[model samples]
Target: MIPMRMPWRQGDVLDLASIGSRVDSLTDLSTIDGGPGARLTAVRTQAQAFRREFIETGTPDSVTTCDLVTLPYPTRFGLFRASRAIAPFLAITNRLLVIRWHESDGTPRVLLFEPSDVELGRYTPYFDKLAGRTPDVVSKRMVTEHATVLTHLARLRIDPSEVDYLMFDHLHTQDLRRWIGTTAPQPDLGEQPTPVFPRAKVIVQRDELAAMADLHPLQRPWYQPGTYRDVPPEAFLPIDGSVVLGPGVAVVKTPGHVFGNQSLVLNTATGVWVSSENVIAAECLTPEHSRMPGLARWAREWGQEVVLNANTIETTVDQYNSIVLEKTLADRSQRDSRFLQFFPSSELTASWTNPGTSPTFTHGAIAHH
Candidate 1:
């Protein structure tokens, strides 16, 4: 096994109990009338509040059920750098997730993580050029027919308007205005961009929003310009650190890939499920001695802390700490000693057929009870 350092003891559990209160303590950005400076102050204050609260409290109460629905988008294997042999040529699923859970009062809530709009051609550059635009069109059709987020929700009979929240682990090539609508006129339509989920609040880390507003040159290309510029402040639910969405659901800052990167933690029938893109596949979390290959093996050979999305690394130390915390949490939440069950928001295509994976969806269900 690759001798990796474990950040926490085998029996230690993550403290989550005060998360709801911490989230509630955050200043409502809509109420502040000042510019970005005021927003930044509020965000910093919120972060401090969360850290203080977490230090005082232990773990939160578990929820009854946490259901996940996978929505696959078209993308290339090279994005994950699995194996050089097939990486450049292979087509794979860029899976996103829709999480449904109940609050303390038993109110139903839906949260969409990394929901993509492939139909808008946002991911075309990631595909094989020789395959031409045909692959892009074909991939969109495949996802829409087999695993579009809306299609899966439709099958579950969940209305988009009923979705309570939307979030992303980090902002990379996301166009929120496409889903939540914009107040300004669209150049193409000369009208406001229509909201896909009219009632949902978009949750974003305060730091992440600040960075997007003034993105570095290197990070600019990965984001869709002006996407959030016209969004009303009321639609945003910004948090600084860990915050409980409900009894069993919470979003915790797991920064490394990006300063604002966070992970979704859920208490499910199976175990604790963390949905983030920090680790692209379950294989990355396996023990070093388990005979890994491709990206996992490369990581082992290079002594890299974790296999991460190439474009998002702000610092290696932060990423390493985040990965260790996630792994430790997953280990602590195991339903069985034989495995760990953390879910990656953008799931690997290999996970569907592979056993011993961190998060498998073959038996996943949208339980109503």
Candidate 2:
């Protein structure tokens, strides 16, 4: 049906302007408003402009389908930190930003927000599973990013304290349960799991998450670099995505191999930049065949994965880093997290994608941390 669903394989090439025209859905933009009172206005005037640019550059023919789903802002979740984590700096910032996204009429809808510290780090049974783990502090790059968000919020005079949860609009139910020790109904499996966060909002669209799953480009042998491993039902959510943990930031679903696998998208003055979390290379969360309990099995089901980010978007990784590394920010050092110098071709690169080479659905992803 969808060209035999494959990971980042070479496909059609298109631009953003065409993509905008091809996709019927557009961002509501009202979500960006501070709250209900200000009369329905565009969420962020700045974001609206960025959206225009993003659509203008995307390629339509290369578009792949994503089964990714989306929810509202302020989705809450817990974040685990590892000292030797690949993106340790991003982990810290996760505490403040909630990355959420949604899909509407074949387009990806995204949003960013903040959550209260208590709501974000709520302890779950899974915490006991992470006995050997500890929290990750903010990296220099993260601090720089935080500073930028703060500057924007300050200029708007929005009190950060008002935020109770940095919710993500998207996440995998399996991963959600594992992270928070909550149970969800597996009607598909005729299994009833304990349901936690009865109040937590979840998006139930199927095709988008499925499309997102196809991005895992290369699968290696059980021991190779870009391969995938079978994950346990306990490890990931039925859906494929992650919630954002911080303010003005969100996590988008980038299914490579690992369940609960995610990519980070930061919204700054410069523009929106989605990170390639589990795409290409052995360093990704999902390595070649290395399945464990409590993870997403779809990762192994699909072959290797790749994230393609090959368009000349306004924001540059260098500029993004500079924004995060502002003097006022004292988070992690530049050495802490590796920042991209240039946006590589999706066809050539394993872990980066844009509208040109890959298919993406927009949605509201939560922010947390």
Candidate 3:
């Protein structure tokens, strides 16, 4: 049953025919096809075609978004121009997106996006420093409650071994050694951590790999390269460009937040949805409705579709264009038609403590059959 359910094989060639969705799912999608301009044009064209065929038509078995943890993040990072609304941080929840879809043959499959192992994640220097810098009014726990990806799997009745893929929007603050196991024993887990999702092939963008290998000074604090290095190479299934995983799902390259940033696009019972950390709040996409001070006005002034989560300015133009691509490829929210269905994988939530800094709109959880 397990082998029969797997849609991908270890050594199977990922040619267009084998990839199943008829979309370009290559490992070197970001190798600058003709140059950066050509690559952007090419990705945009593919995204529109992908949306028309996959996202606009089909439904996944279901896309259940479960809360893994909640923590505070910088306000400036959440919105491009937060103005005088709040100081320091706002509450954000990182969700584990459980995507269950099927191959054309009707074999069942599951993909876990952002199964963040919190313990390993703290190794990020910037995130680690946040613990000490947060005001005394903030709780030291970093999150109100915390749980592992496995705990959520149990609650959802998803067996760990059955998961087909494990992925993140980008590698920011992610430490995967625990999920896929490391090549050598280390102090972090006292030994090489045993694999949590044993059969899962981790999906990563090839460009993200390059970004990690040659980090710019600005990118260093956000990534813990040390934690990623020891993970066995076989554990990863790196793709270069946009590729549809199964019905209603494709990993689209949306670089800017990081050189290798990608967004998960899923077609659900309601409409098309794009998930990533490209923008932290729903208002960032639909700035017209934003109640947050200055956010809406800034977008109107600049004619921007979405205000970026500008933590790293490395590829600002590409990131902005990527957000537009995501917005273009998504359906308007079924809950609130005014907003696009761009779910921030780590969504910023409304909190009274962070006055004048709440999101204009919040789709608490995605609605799916």
Candidate 4:
């Protein structure tokens, strides 16, 4: 077990009340169906019951749930490394890669890269807010705090030469700006002039580069209609096609969702497994505006479509892609259209007069009887 500090009062307990309060539609419950959701619910209820049973009956699991605390930093770092190691190959371009290393002799090292200036500003403030300190301080502290973990990796039982990179997914990177959106001095951050690994040339897909360029007010070439938005133009480079990075690893362009967003499909005799970071998340299963296909277009943003290889390896498989064109067209048709909405109280009542049940008021985050 790893010793770590809890950031919140509830420790490892997820705030169900907070999650429930955020639900605005039935679609919210769609993702909560059987399997993990059910399992999660059971765990929560069992924990509550155990508390009551132990407090009243003086009996409980030998190990209490609260007592089995999670190791925060190590877990986070592990996941971060995994995302970075897998992303470029997986075709994921949105996540940031932070590296920390320690020499076997005990010297500490920390490396940080923002890929670009916009990503840097977004993540810097996020690290600051989350750590309750300035971004640089938080970064330094993360290294100091996880020095032991770094030491362990450095002195690997297996040769260091055999190991390559570490990678993982980071969803919160995009959400970092939510707290400071359109409020204060949110200036446009410039490119990251100094890279974390100055000696190593960062491998950025052409698509990612194009997408980055399009984010600038002056570079609008990538966002033209018929061309996928959010993908960088370089993603279309011929070299991007099934290029071998290592003996076993290869980079394949699987764009969908955003123009440059990709997934890494690992090929081993066992099977081919794809790691698509942001193709979908738990929240996507919900029936929210975000899930609606055409919803983002009005804001000049476009949804990414995953590219699956077929017999030709250049086009989508016929059997699988039959519906792709139709769905894409439907989504395009709804572009710039308003979402479904309810009317004012009097109008709603008049429209619902024939209904048997009493009318319920619907507001963004509030529903009244």
Candidate 5:
């Protein structure tokens, strides 16, 4: 028989105080210190620097290509509360990106951002509680067609082992050990290190890895324990600052949704596309507009500078700064254009079709700028 799982208790792993101390010990890349005040200061100083560097670096001369694939996943209507008034009840997709570019030396590189291949059954408990619906209700809402990451890759005729790099915006409900493997057997999975992408390297912020070990009690629900315990140190490409992956692709330390959260920025023919889960939709960035909803609208009414995703409030000020930095980066990329075209990762799915209609899968290449 399968072993029964024990309920998580306060001391089952680590205490709240210890978690906070661990987070404090993690390296923070921003100029400002760890409090809300420093985060607010970072909103102006660090965000400006982030924007300036990307603009000054200029787009790579080599042809850069990108495409968005909407992977099927379980999502609640309430998650997109801002747009609930418009559509009421609807399903959404987990937007994933496939990026291809060449280095200065002309070596071909392939990167996958949030290659989510989650099993809904594994997360049924969280979905049931989050949507305040029964198991039956949740099951009916989940879209199963074209769900797995392998199927999408198969359609593209690309092999997972050929991938050069893999990244996630944060560690929320992710199990990278399955893909990258570990040095020893994982507690939950009694399996040795068996990497799915044999040659690929996983890139993550060092601060994020630290935060995962000792998460805030409130933030614990979104992470899986022992997920990274077995991952060999050499397999990880942990960064403390912005890292240029290729000529036109860079992973910038945004740090808002989580203490170690980061965003992927790519210079595309359309414009700079930022792959991030920090905000649910593009509307979150334009809080000044009246049509903006939820925390964004509230922020505008309260005369706040920016709005955030409202997932983790451990660092509210830092989240605000991260959002501002995203906006600045998008703005600088479009200085010559008449309007903005910053693509929120989710927008790729939500904007694909009208609400209540079946999803129409689409794909395209992001030509060189």
Candidate 6:
């Protein structure tokens, strides 16, 4: 790693606005230049080149999911009419991805993706307003498995200080005050919060990080705007558009879920897998196979290739294109070739916690080789 001052202003270091500035609409770019299909092909070519280089020498040797927590998600949001699931609330499991890889120069790096403090997440008004009716006793039982990001990292024998990058698919329900440390002291703790990964820098999209400061009315209920105020500027590595963090790994810009929403792409021994909440299940990529009553029929009716978790959709078209980019970039699933290998960072699972819902297929982990 280059010797740089701690808390460096990495967010300011990259000129990331080109992705959002020139285009009047990302979808419009489609007609002029063979649309998103052409653009996606270019990206896939580049991503595969990166992967081939990694595999010939060495790809990522360490990559695993750290199951964090589960919550009650409204069925409507998870399926977005892709599934005619009648359940009011479905079980959504969120996890963190711990990735270790080497740059072409041989520097090792570690990134923690979506290492959320789920307990703190319960307060999100968007969720509370939707799943709030469930009793805590019932919600607590919703997830049969539980783990913390910090605890899971330790079990893997990784030290917090050794962690290099902290990332998220989006900042919708994240509170980084404890993870990155706060500049101000707070109640209860009596002192400023110390960071979990003191030397780590968060790699977030430039626009996404900026949006957290002054959230839109639509964004307010979901973002913890207050949690970021005390974070030091040097603690972030904000970039614009798609970025290949290292060999075999790229964080591609996937707008629509949020303007700055991006998905993680990793090339594994089995194949390339894109991970994000762009959709919540493996079948969402191939909705025709969805067992949910409405999902398959709705997808077939519309000639749609992907079904979104459309709880928030001011930019639905862009999300549709973005998810297609993911599906295009990923390899077909080994277990089920009919589906793409794109995995949901937060997968839906059947648990007594939310009795009425179940995913046609679940991919809880992405460990290959």
Strongest candidate by lDDT: 3
RMSD of each: 11.6, 19.1, 6.0, 23.4, 7.9, 6.1
| lDDT tens digits, residue span 88-185, model 6 | 77878888898898765677788888888776665577766655666767655764448877789889889999898888899888877778887778
lDDT per residue for candidate 1 within 1-369, as digits (tens), equals 222221112333323342254456544443667764565455556544643444333333332222232323222222234343322322234455666666666776777776665444353233223335456774444332235567657865779989888888886756666677877787754678878888887777776766665666656546654555576666777666768766556687777677788887665555455667776555455534223335446666776534554454575455555665566555332333433565655555443223323232221222323
Candidate 6 versus the native: TM-score? Answer: 0.85
Please give, for residues 108-150, the per-residue lDDT of candidate 5 as tens digits.
6778787654652245334436545546554444433444666
In terms of TM-score, how similar is model 5 to the real structure?
A: 0.72
Sequence-dependent TM-score of model 1: 0.67
- The TM-score of candidate 4 is 0.28
Question: Higher-lDDT candidate among 3 and 5?
Answer: 3
Can you tell me which runs of candidate 6 are displaced by over 4 Å?
A: 1-11, 15-58, 128-132, 143-145, 352-356
* Runs off by more than 4 Å, candidate 2: 1-93, 98-110, 113-122, 131-253, 257-272, 275-338, 341-369
> What are the runs in model 1 whose C-alpha is more than 4 Å off?
1-19, 23-86, 89-92, 121-145, 287-305, 332-339, 350-369
Ten contiguous residues with the weakest lDDT in model 1: 1-10
A best-first ranking of the candidates according to their lDDT comes to 3, 6, 5, 1, 2, 4
In terms of TM-score, the best-performing candidate is 3
Best-to-worst TM-score order: 3, 6, 5, 1, 4, 2
Give the runs in model 3 whose Cα sits over 4 Å from its true position: 1-46, 134-137
Better of 1 and 3 by TM-score: 3
- How well is each residue in 1-369 modelled by candidate 3, as lDDT tens digits? 111111223344444444444354323335655766676676567567667777544778888888877887788877867445755778888988898977878788899998898777866899778766666566654465566788889998999988988889998998888788877797857887888888888787777776677677888888877776677777777676677778787887787888888899888777788999998887788888888888878878877667888888778877877887788788888777889888898898877667767777887677575
User: How would you encode candidate 2's per-residue C-alpha lDDT over 1-369 as one tens digit per residue?
Assistant: 122331222332223232112222223223445643231222223334433444333221111111111111100110111112122111112222323332234433322222222222223223222322433441121121223333444543444442222232223112333112223444432554342332233321132334344433321111111111221222222322233323323333322223223334443433344433122111122222222121123344443221212111122322222222111111111222322211110101111211111111111122222
